[model samples]
Target: MSRTLSVLFILVCYVIQGQSQQVDQDSIKNLRLNILPVVFYTPETGLGYGALGLSTFRLKGEELSTRPSSVQLGITFTSKKQFLMFMPYEFYLDEEKWRFKGELGYYKYFYNFYGVGMDSREEDKELYTADFPRFRLAAYREIFQDFSIGLGYEFDGYHVLEPEPDGLLDTSLDIIGKEGGTISNIGFLALYDTRDNIFHPTKGWYVEGAFYHSARWLGSNYSYQKIELDTRYYQQIKGNVILATNLFLGTRSNGTPFQDLNYLGTKRTRGFDNRRYLDKNEVSLATELRFPLYKRLKGAVFGATGTVIPSLDQTFKASYKGAVGGGLRYIVNKKEGTRLRVDYGISGDGGQFYFTINEAF
Candidate 1:
């Protein structure tokens, strides 16, 4: 019952200004700005309208071979009276030896939650409204070719604005985070990336592992730990044809909050409701076949399977979910390989459409 259609009107403007004469002349020091007005529809949000802006630029002495850094901002409001504002950015500094990325966002939104675990029934769905502010920051220094290690901080202040009367969230004593609270965590990150291009990689591998711990001493209401591993591979098959695949594994300690539990049906799974299943552990694998269609336009077909388990011992006995989808991509920034993506996915429950800025992985 989830769907989105984003009509994008793009405006691109380039600004060229000289900094100090001391700046390196070999650097490409121009800024490119793209603005798009977006309109979309979803059963949960009704009709939504928004504006998305992206600014891409290179630092003073950075070479063209280095990936360009980008800052993206978005604001949206729905007819249902929900709204969201977010800013996400990525920077490649010091000749691409240092990488910094994160997101800062505030959401006044509604989410559907079923009772936790794979056994949760579809009929048990409940809608809840919440407002929250989120901040995440990570910095990594390349230790070797295509390898880096880093540290990150994450924080979220979540408050429930509305909960269904007599619903599971209101009555269930087993549910943690039913009455939202602060979530503060510190984490370690390791990444090994060899992609030819940041936006659209035709060949390479990207592997990342992260571990995070949240404790009362860290200003968290609950104490828990989380571990996640995401691995991706991309390869060119033939002329203008590419194959991309991803596998993600995640697990959390027993004390993890319900909101922090592993779930399918996000950008990761795409076809089910958001947080369709929740549990302490999860495994998902997806693959896509990408090929050129026309000038500035590309096409892709993707399939994914995933499952969530309440405990590690139950992993082998878990019920799995599957999704299949196809989408179109329009190259928004040809030089940087940035694209506008629109995808429609189908699952056992139903189908959903997604509109976004980049690849799901």
Candidate 2:
């Protein structure tokens, strides 16, 4: 039942922008403001949490070069300590509009939870220690004028404080791979956007599809395959209001050795963790009404629903899976109608609040 799509509040992924086919007549030191806030909750893994995050974007010229790059920073807050992260994203484009890009990223999650959110058992008092400094590398290429492809790899091997005598205890809650463990994954990514631009969302369609697998130094002894599909549409309503609708469909293979069921996260769901429940397939739908109130203010209200199954063939079980929620939204950049956002939602168990940039497409 973990297949229910939940949108955790804080940090997540990025959809790369390829090299443009044509140059702009003029360009400038374009600036973009960004923010992301997330929170996690689970009845089985104890009470979970999210990181505190703030971000900004600075790009030199939109017309001077077909390829562009951006810089980002983020932070995470758990039960123990604090964490910081930094990222640099670079991209290239060819005459045929084929886009090539790469990204470097690092994240450190500091905390003191010796044993939390691990499993169904709570009797063991044994504990281990660890600190992780993960390095991530990603590349994206644009193929077929209508389709863009992407790939990413990362290795995280911080440290486990010290293993306890019980033989099965650790300091971190991550079960897929612990602090002493190095988790890595490679992905096949693609996106199709029929809009004026990727950042400035006006009116058009957007679609994203990706497949990912993990290995040893990359992640415990398990390997998993995930297929995700997302689609969105925007329409201008009367009185200058806009209507937005989005759908997400995803599924994971149960063959992964180090992985739990794929819990839907921020991308498709609005109020759940990536591992709350486990299932093979998930489906989500969301619709919103947005109104620009000021030059820097916009408001929105939306509803979302999703469900997960152990497999595509068993997608209709009504057991302990999935979630649903609805909440209000605030927008920045009413002029171009782009920039930042804040959201709040209520699910089957509780409610969640989140903040971020872009239109959530």
Candidate 3:
């Protein structure tokens, strides 16, 4: 079976098993825990198996109105010798006045590289393997209603195990991070959010801006600065129907690694291969229409357009890429409004599928 399909089947099994499992609840601690097994198949990975544990809780003295915090831990290994271990957590403290979120993980994985610009051709695609340990942490405190200022630190120790001989990485002396290296950065962010719901917003605005710098003094192999801005708006069109729009902007300094450059594809731009187009600057815009399909089920149609360029001045002149797609959502946690999302996107090259546990943005 195809990798995506096999994963979907496993997720379906998980849903069935999840419904029958008894959640461990501690009333005194206001915590609930669920543990499950993961299994899937794919041509590249052969058989993959893992375990996942998730815990949701409210801090002591925190009112029920405060958002519930969650921590997820997972470990997986595949027959082809790939493996991953990770912990991701999000917490709301002080009655929503403070928020903290981050992830720590290590993984051995493969990625497709197709040169590093909008003009890159599909024929240049090459697969490479790498292993990396990553750490990311962010803390935010609301200064006033719905406005927050934050600080964050991130680290990634990347080691390329295999690079295609005679390929771009091997042939190009200009490519930074060709051998993989450490990326450490500290950043500051400002956010303004008014969305009524974090999982599925019906109406409101979310705007965020951040700046980070990685330098030799900070244990980074390369020195560079990056700036990013993301803005989103949601509006209720009618009963149970909503329209959402997003715009993203990013730029990095000269010494930035190719892997760290802004890209045209990610969760932000569906339908295209991940990091299909990479450069020093990028601008993207997307919109989605969401509506209820049935009880606890939702549907969405989205479109996006973006471009990557070496500099901001060339943004308008750069070749643009676009995509259109649709997706389904099944609510998994009613209280938290979390949903299992499945989307299929189409672009000039072909179709791409995505499956996950939350909205793209």
Strongest candidate by lDDT:
1
Q: Candidate 1 or 3, higher lDDT?
A: 1
Q: How high a TM-score does candidate 1 get? A: 0.91
Candidate 2: which stretches are off by over 4 Å?
Answer: 1-28, 31-70, 76-79, 86-131, 134-138, 154-180, 215-220, 257-261, 265-267, 318-338
Error of 3 at 341 (Å): 0.8
Candidate 2 lDDT, 1-361, residue by residue in tens: 2312243222343323222233332432334434444454433222334433222222333343332333444544444443445454443334314444343444443222222222222233333344556565545555666667677664555444345544543433444444344456677778785654444445778887777777655454556677878888877777767777888777777554222344444545665543333345667687777776765567777776666665666555434333454433443333233355566655554555555545656
User: Model 3, residue 293: what's the lDDT?
Assistant: 99
Ranking of all candidate structures by their TM-score, best first: 1, 3, 2
CA lDDT scores, all candidates in order: 0.83, 0.50, 0.81
TM-score for candidate 3, please give it. 0.90
Report the Cα lDDT for candidate 1. 0.83
C-alpha lDDT (0 to 100) for residue 146 of candidate 1: 92
List, residue by residue over 54-81, the lDDT tens digit for candidate 1: 7677877778789988888889999999
TM-score (C-alpha, index-matched) for candidate 2: 0.64
Off by over 4 Å in 1: 1-28
Residues 267-351, candidate 3, lDDT per residue (tens digit)? 7789887778899999999999999999999999999999998899997888998999999988766766767678888778666
Q: At residue 98, what lDDT does model 1 achieve? A: 97
Q: List the residue pairs that clash in candidate 3.
A: none
